[model samples]
Target: MNKIDYKSPIGLIEIEGSAEAVRSILFVERDEIVNTIHHETPEVLVDCLNQLDEYFRGERHVFTFPYHFEGTDFQQTVWNALTTIPYAETGSYKDIAVSIKNEKAVRAVGTANGKNKLSIVIPCHRIIGANGKLTGYAGGLWRKEWLLQHERTFNK
Candidate 1:
């Protein structure tokens, strides 16, 4: 995967990935590729760029590209639950734990959300505090709010 740069409203994004799939996407002030697994072009990367563009424009609410994120089994379980969060809907850490049949794993659910690598594609923004307050996010809370607002504005 080679590093790629994407211009977004917030800033330029740096993502690492291979020809078959994307591994990660990071926002930065300038071009800085890291941990890229360079792969064939016009295939995996082409679709990634297209979806990313649509997402930034609020024209896309879901992603359908192939990704290869690595994580612990528990983390993957929590991340999988995140995908079930409706496009513009929100959920609590407790809600996730219940969905996964681990009703007592609220703290673990929060940890899983904190470790999510797919970011917007996984819709981690939809997760909030139990009281509905915005909580942790790898992308920063401001970005989370922005994403949720972006979804709400277009989802209707």
Candidate 2:
């Protein structure tokens, strides 16, 4: 797998993937940044970085690059549902459960959401508490708030 670190507006982002498809994109601390020399970066990783740049600049709302998700079927289902949420919009765990035709799986939906490896691209940050409050985000609530605010600003 190939990996690269990008300094994003929020923090450092680590993107991992192969030439075929992007495997994961997650936030990392400064210390977590890997030190490795790549002879040549893959085209896909470079493309993802450009798209991310566009996203942070508020010039792009959707990601069109190729990506791969590795998780259980339930997790994949939840991730797929997350993508359906329009840019700058939010959804609740209960809402996702109902969308998947499993209204009783609200808690399960939350669990699956936390397991999401791909961050902004998969849009796990868009999920919120049913009460309309910001909830748990693997990337931290502050970053989630920043992302929401960022999108809201650009959505206009």
Compared with the true structure, all predictions reach lDDT values of 0.78, 0.91
What is candidate 2's lDDT per residue for 98-135, written digit by digit as tens? 99999999999999999988899999888889899999
Residue lDDT tens for model 1, 23-135 = 87666656443323335453666677678889888788879988876898988888888999988899999999999999999998888788776667777789998898999
Give per-residue lDDT, candidate 1, residue 90.
98
Highest TM-score, which number?
Answer: 2
TM-score of candidate 1 against the unseen true structure: 0.87
Candidate 1 residues lying further than 4 Å off, grouped into runs, are 29-42
lDDT of 2 at 44: 90
Each model's TM-score?
A: 0.87, 0.95
